[model samples]
Target: MRSCKDYSAKIPNVKPALCEAAQLQDSKARSVLGRPIWSRDVQAQGAPLRVLVLGGIHGDEMSSSSLVFHWIALAQTPPSDTPVPISWRFIPTLNPDGMFAKPARRVNARGVDLNRNFPTPNWARDARHYWEERTRRDPRRWPGTQPLSEPESRFLLEQIDNFKPNLIVSVHAPYGVLDFDGPSVPPSRLGRLYLDQVGIFPGSLGNYGGIHKGVPVVTIELPSASRTPQEAEMRQMWMDLLRWTTERLGSSASTTPASPDLPKSP
Candidate 1:
């Protein structure tokens, strides 16, 4: 329930223009830990919707991270027209500390992959160690020396509690695949969107498709390296998502469906 103003003050070096736009919105967005989560709102006018977009869960996936940051930058200006009854909260560059320093790591400075850090009953033992190797023990995927240990991971956990988004998207890259988690999202529509926009095969996030049930989380992987890509592809991904949101899933409001029984660890 934190206001945009509150978040603006919390994140240092937030663009001044963005701060101005946040002031125009009536409601605010908060981070998981009660600090401000980066966000912007244009009144539904009469109808309201909530959408959350996450970037930089993996430090090496800068291609995806850049697009999300671009969206945040856009949110600084009030939309020339009222956007579809949507309240958008964009968490760009979630692990800024890691991203600024490392190119392709998925872990935070403490070396934990935020994606793998989510509490699941069946996470493979030493699963976090895989990330450690990926980063060459760069301290990016060390699993924080414990669970839910990094600020970025904790921030996202809190965002889920506070924003309660109808749809959440996490961007990643180079795999040429789109993976989804959560139970409520229709598999047909979710896969179609990825195949249509990026020509990537579709799959489920870590095969635990029902971890959070109703809160469908779409993970889009771009064809870019951790740092480079054709500007066109990057822009297209953004436009496709915007179009998908405004046209396809924009109005679909889903709650967190009950977590389903996850498969055994691989």
Candidate 2:
């Protein structure tokens, strides 16, 4: 519970009780500064569909992590309507060092952007070129000396292999749009955010997981970095995501009701 309290304090819209209810487990993977990267795996009865939800890749987008916590609570209840039995793996804070930094940095302690440090196709060439030429060598978006150079990136790559999720949902912030990759029909909207289909970048998770690995990646760029949507709005986004997932991947079943633990809007 101490870890829950500590983590919840860093992000807006999340209280200690919310994180405690999430019951996050330490992955035993250490960050650049030796901070523990925590995760929670929720399994439904013989769940045929496996989905991975990741947040805090940039660390500064704390709201993304907040949303993951809320969803963890939402996922606890098996809605009678939706028959989509889901195996869920939630990584709430993938970049703890960056997230816990005094000012909440976008990059890790080593100054590498974990989001841009994945091993995409031609990463050696394209990653460097994109960093140097396209980004004008932006320090915040640095791809690192090599792909998977950071332990944080390596840990994620390991999850993609070990977990072998059918869909990967990566949450980010301050962009206010939804982006999807792979063969599935993308969700048109989640809450107020609409699909934008942003182009992929070198060594990006969307490119590595969604394009190269053939796994569907639903990237949610929330509207704000510091503040999350209201509880009703967040639940609406979760419901939309649930509906979309069942429609696209699960058995053509009914939609789910709200998590019983979650309070209704006033």
Best prediction by lDDT? 2
Pick the TM-score winner: 2
Candidate 1 displacement at residue 239 in angstroms = 3.9
**Candidate 1 lDDT over residue span 34-101, tens digit each:** 33334333223333356677776676666665556555555445345534555566665575554554
Judged by whole-model lDDT over C-alpha atoms, candidate 2 comes out at 0.88
Tens digit per residue, CA lDDT, model 2, 155-264: 99988888778789999999999999887889999999999998999989999999999999999999999999999999999999888998788853223421211111
User: Looking at candidate 1, what is the lDDT of residue 92?
Assistant: 59
Q: Which ten residues in a row have the lowest lDDT in candidate 2?
A: 257-266
Q: What 10-residue stretch in candidate 1 is worst by lDDT? A: 199-208
Question: Given candidate 1, what's the lDDT at residue 124?
Answer: 45
Error of 1 at 54 (Å): 1.2
RMSD of each: 9.3, 5.8
C-alpha RMSD between model 2 and the true structure = 5.8
